[model samples]
Target chain A: MTEQIAWIAVDWGTSNLRAWGIGPAGAVVATAGSDQGMGKLAPQEFPAALMAVANQLALPDEPVDVVICGMAGARQGWLEAPYLEAPTDLIALGQGAVHPNMPDERLRVSILPGVCQREGGENVMRGEETQLLGLAVTAPTYAGLVCMPGTHSKWARLEGTRIAGFSTAMTGELFELLKTHSVLRHSLAGDVNGPERDGGFLAGAQDGLDEPEKLLGQLFEVRASALLSGRTPDWCAGYLSGLLIGTEIAANRNQIGTDPVPLIGSATLCALYARVLAMTGAAGRVVDSTEVVLAGLKAARASIA
Target chain B: MTEQIAWIAVDWGTSNLRAWGIGPAGAVVATAGSDQGMGKLAPQEFPAALMAVANQLALPDEPVDVVICGMAGARQGWLEAPYLEAPTDLIALGQGAVHPNMPDERLRVSILPGVCQREGGENVMRGEETQLLGLAVTAPTYAGLVCMPGTHSKWARLEGTRIAGFSTAMTGELFELLKTHSVLRHSLAGDVNGPERDGGFLAGAQDGLDEPEKLLGQLFEVRASALLSGRTPDWCAGYLSGLLIGTEIAANRNQIGTDPVPLIGSATLCALYARVLAMTGAAGRVVDSTEVVLAGLKAARASIA
Candidate 1:
């Protein structure tokens, strides 16, 4: 007999959506995804978008539990899911999940709420909370600083499964803007390989780590170095990347302890962050973002069950 | 008789070109400007673009001296006027001026050289050098820090008529990019006036000044503040402006001594910088940029007279 599907898990972000059908034993039985992300769909369109992915899986006769995460629960998304305040336990995430009104009787849907910090400074995260929950499930005793590198990189302090506080740095976004739109665009062309790339990266990283306060002043040097000294575009690009990442690390240096920080993100980006962290006399380990998010969804499913 | 144009002064920048016809008494006899800046013209096209403005003034039978400054001297501009290393006397700027081949015998164009600093870091200034020279000509005893706020805000250390060194911050450019392209774009809207605008600006300025190192981390707070606490777009815009200006001031705090900084730029921008400078316990006085550029051009003309 074919393995009976237990439930459905969906990670609906701004640009894309991914869904998985889990079997009774918590193993993925089927997988599907679409470009129909939260950004594209209206409140009424969300049901159809989800069904497009869900229809791929073999649905049982009865209505199956469907847990959704990310921007799908935002105020502008399918249904508004109010944020749970920070210092919230990972285990308690499922209890806060809000049920969106489902049109089809075959689907029982619940969207997980995001987390927000209000005391120190205003901050919010929709999708990352689930990943943090997954991290907790995968490693029950792990607790310290966690760095999730992306466009808006987040650095969170965790106490066991609870997120104490977190801050975001717009490093990746700024790098993209500077590379594509700013005056440094021309200076940041071409590609370099091997030791030269490493050298350039290290030099810029060192500058950023040592004197982040001088960042605004140092940015023009990229263009000047190219114009005056004819520095290659590849070196400039590498240097810019290292500078932004290094500055991000330096900004959060106060929270990073001697313990090895778990960097959760794509391998390439996490690797860059790890290298910069090592340069600052700190250790970092890569944690696959996909694995954690899935584990977090599973944990949430179990909480509701 | 019609006032014979003694010479012409042109500030050919990236986006716009402005020309003035000087009388023998050193007063402006005629003025003209166009969108045909250095960025749009080719090597051969420079003559016609210059004439567009020059033709407006009364011309004599002989070729008239046309002293040009700004990006017109850039490598990509009409003619490449090599940068004179910093600490060179401002009065000697005319000596380094290069003359591009002119098709019109009625115009003898000389583009003034910009200043470059290579000892500490790579830095080059084109048009602003003329203004600095103008400042030197107007106030011969002035020797201190000069702040010029624009798209690329410049802070230079001056000794008499010499520019000792200078650094640039892309504060204004970054602000525009963030407001138009970043996620915070939605949050930074509305028209704030009076005390509300000042309050927002001061609050953001204080944060930026107090914790410049955390700038990267603090940027997302703009979006968060709007998302969580419902900040008005006007306030957000004002805050962003304050934050950037404050951060710029903080970075250059070392160069800013007890001496009052002479801010050279548009009156509106200079006022903002002056306010931020005051907040840092430093004083700033506005100097009209146009007056200085004209004076500097006149000085260059006199040197070659």
Candidate 2:
């Protein structure tokens, strides 16, 4: 059964490493992950970290192709996979993949290069590019705006299989920073992502959409609302999240255009973005990040094959 | 000369304590300060911290009236002064002052209450209210919008000597957080507050003012611009500062009205703000925060007297 495995697919990011064992027929045989992210590993540690998971599947002695994407290719990661400038063809991403030397003869890893925008304002994305490639593979002719939300949310405008231009928003990072490290932290002491879907979240999103420039002031109102309005901790958390997300959406509203913005990410995060996008009168279609990442890696593998 | 000290004006905030010795003739005599701020002091440590500075100005063993403002009056400070609800008469702030028991017989400290707005949304300000009082004392008939720029930048609408309504923007804090904690820290390394007045600051501010909702995305550009445009560290610092401040100003543009907004803060900081405010088509009159605080404390003293 293990002999059926043909290649491997990995999404190696800053904080975590996820891998899926793909069969010869393109079916996923097994999947695994660890906290051994690129940020945690030095050049020497990359092979062992990958082998730690590779050995679990009792991979045969034959060489196996492993398609990797994300921070693993950063300058500080296992090997530097230089950024491919934007307006890049998704099909060409495979050409940008750099092969990192591995101790195990059985594992041949190709790390995909992240994309960089050198003009306008400098911008870069590592893993999301793979996700976009995956999205491209899923719908070969799909074109419009694509948003992939996470710690560093990426918004891209795609023309067929080529990414025309893209922008990254610090919404997720800002939300986390405000939730855990700010004065509003006192008011949001409880579950920062509580089950309670308080109206404060929608209200905050609406406020951000209505007046995105006033965002910093609106954020202060979270603490103020807690102090004066006696808003619950859950509501405060929801409001802050809403405001950050709403502002991000409003900031990129023009990019969304008339097309249904395709949101690629985990269900929880995508749901939030989708809901907010709908609130802004834009349609959103959610796609699981795993599906897109796998499809993206598979596409890269096929291209290399 | 020491005995000429009629009273002590103290601005005890979260991180530091600043005091001014006032003569009976209403002139500032000598001044001193200590690192022991509200955040650093326990209830028992407050008096000693105050004494550390108070003792420097040697005097007879007689009680000296110390009018204190800022976080020293917070629930967690020397003594809780409670909030004076907004639409509050600046003159009444002194009436709401609370006295904390002191072991040093020579110090009779009166801590002023903060101002809180309960309507619309909950908002609170401790030290800024005193500055408003001081501004009022300087210009008794003054009326219009006042901007006190700091960690929690405040904007207040005043009707004569009363605070009609007010709002706080976490501009300074956000700047600090992004500079020190966020990924932008890489580009903003070295002097967080550099002497360089790169045109980048004004440019960033103008961009923020022009399109505030695009702030989160624009912030990413700081990093992008650095990576691609090779922007210097000083330029990055100024640009970030401008973007945050400009966005804050853009958000609250509706409140600026036609009058010259009074900016109360240190000369260096207020100058940056004044410049930004001017860029936004409004005139900004810089008022030294020290002068305003002292005048505010003096006004409170007279009201109590």
Candidates, DockQ: 0.79, 0.75
Model 2: how far is B82 from its true place, Å?
2.7
Show model 1 residue runs off by greater than 4 Å: A191-196, B190-195
lDDT of 1 by residue, B183-242 (tens): 878887656553466777888888889888878877899899898988888778888888
- Provide the DockQ value for model 1: 0.79
Q: Tell how far residue B93 is off in model 1, in angstroms.
A: 1.2
Clashing pairs in 2: A122-B224, A224-B122, B134-B296
Most DockQ-accurate candidate: 1
A182 Cα displacement, candidate 1 (Å) = 1.3
> Mind giving the per-residue lDDT tens digits that candidate 2 earns over A75-184?
88999998999888887888888888998889988999889987656798989988898899888778889998887899998876798889999999998888778888
Native contacts recovered by model 1: 0.74
Cα lDDT tens digits, model 1, A147-222, are 9999989888888789988888998899999988899998976664434667778878988898888788788888
Over 4 Å off, model 2: A191-197, B60-62, B103-106, B191-197, B257-259
Q: Which prediction has the highest TM-score against the true structure?
A: 1
lDDT of 1: 0.88
lDDT of 2 at A279: 96
